[model samples]
Target: MIDRRGFLRLGAVGGGAVFMSGLYGKAMAAAGYEDFYFVQLSDSHWGYKGPANPEAQNTLRRAVESVNALAVQPDFIVFTGDLTHTTDDAAERRRRMGEFKQIVGGLKVKDVHFLAGEHDASLDNGAAFHEFFGPSNYSFDHKGVHFIAVDNVSDPGARIGEAQLAWLKADLDKQAKDARIVVLTHRPLFDLAPKWDWATRDGEQAMALLMPYSNVTVFYGHIHQENHHMSGHIAHHAAKSLIFPLPAPGSQDKRTPLPWDPAAPGKGLGFREVEAEAKPVAYQITEFPAMKG
Candidate 1:
């Protein structure tokens, strides 16, 4: 059995995406402390009209409503990636981003962080995305944890080139030895499957840059499902999509968007709530689905 710290170390070497297994134990360890909670919503795919999810926009709206209705207002919200679907028309892309902003207008929390997925960046290498959402990569500290948002889906898909890697190194170097680090991006840093554009091109180099950090957690949204693994002390988590869920890698011959089942309505529209606190290092993840009514 792999321990939490050991699991993160293995993720550093093996390049496998890591997630925390003993969630209950970790949460219990941090009991009786002031914990901060943030919501992660991904793959909204605004302006997408398809049979796979006939009510995509409505579903997204429902998700925003759900977040606003939370008993404990989140510290902030993070839209991991895929804010809009790809299209040849630049105006269309901007329109989609516009719609996305409008949909989240109900967000009770003020600070909302955004990242770019391949669909949002690949068309013109994120020119429009950044124009509407600001920098694709940035870093900040909240409640003693260093959070770094990286742009891994830069052209060529899932490649965190030299410049970003250097930036990441610099960012990590500035933090204290024991500060908990949380890295967020659109693609998984591990090689979930390269052929299908699921894994980052040079994720191993990125992982090595994070190896020195004692407590690190990498959160991403792309595959449109929930998955967790461990790399040393670092935990890798993939979030569910607000648009639709895709089959796990190798589970199907081709990775395609799964249609919302009338029989299983409201199945895939959900988001992950992450809580992290200082001292003793703890995290609790709760997944919430959109309200059916």
Candidate 2:
């Protein structure tokens, strides 16, 4: 349902990348807003050790350096999910989480946000993740936009669950019908590829709750590549992973990381910048390599 005008891929400007939607333009126009932008880095899988990415230990650090190199730093930065690789050992999990935090600490921007991916949360119901980061699901406001971070990974079944659904409903009830809304989650609310664990089990209910709001955009990760989709008037954009990329939805028999291309080491791994303009209600998304040439 992605409106034809909802997404415009403005690829690689001055060695960066960006995206914008028609809906964002309209919402900004109605909100009496000020221009602002944020950085989104997803699926770093910080503790991973594998051939999929030989330089796993340095990828996240490179990403941080890339952001630090931005001519104008974003107001804030957010890691959508998979901040760490999964571990059955509880102590090891905590250690990875701690180390991951310390690495991202190099960012020039002090205001950073986090969300949980299944690898970081599904094992112990987000206990380790919560211990390092704060609550997984919450809301905040900036420059006339309402942002909600929903925790679907915490439930193990990939469900937002009934309790959080009530919370979402209550939160939405407080906003104006035209409030500009941004949803950040680890999984797609719509059924992108159910067998691959890409869709939230009860995401439709969550979408129903958000549908009444006229201005809404969703940013997510878990797919490990840049994907754009529309759910009615709402636009969902998936971010690129800092670790490795996966095959496009259902393009292959199995959901596995694409082999790392030694010839192009950083090919499928990167981060993005979202710049929002107030006067015209426009936005531009710019992407950067996790490791620069």
RMSD of each: 7.5, 4.5
The positional error of residue 183 in candidate 2, measured at the CA in angstroms, is 0.4
Measured by TM-score, how close is model 2 to the native structure? 0.93
Candidate 2, residues 4-122, lDDT tens digits: the string is 12332323545555566656444456545877888899999999999999989988999899889866678899899999999999999999999999999888998999999999999
Q: Give the winner by lDDT.
A: 2
Tens digits of per-residue lDDT, candidate 1, 100-151, equal: 8877877899899999988889878889888888999999877766799989
Candidate 2 deviant stretches above 4 angstroms: 1-11, 24-32
Taking all chains together, each candidate's TM-score versus the true structure is 0.87, 0.93
Cα lDDT over the full model 2:
0.87
lDDT of 1 at 31: 36
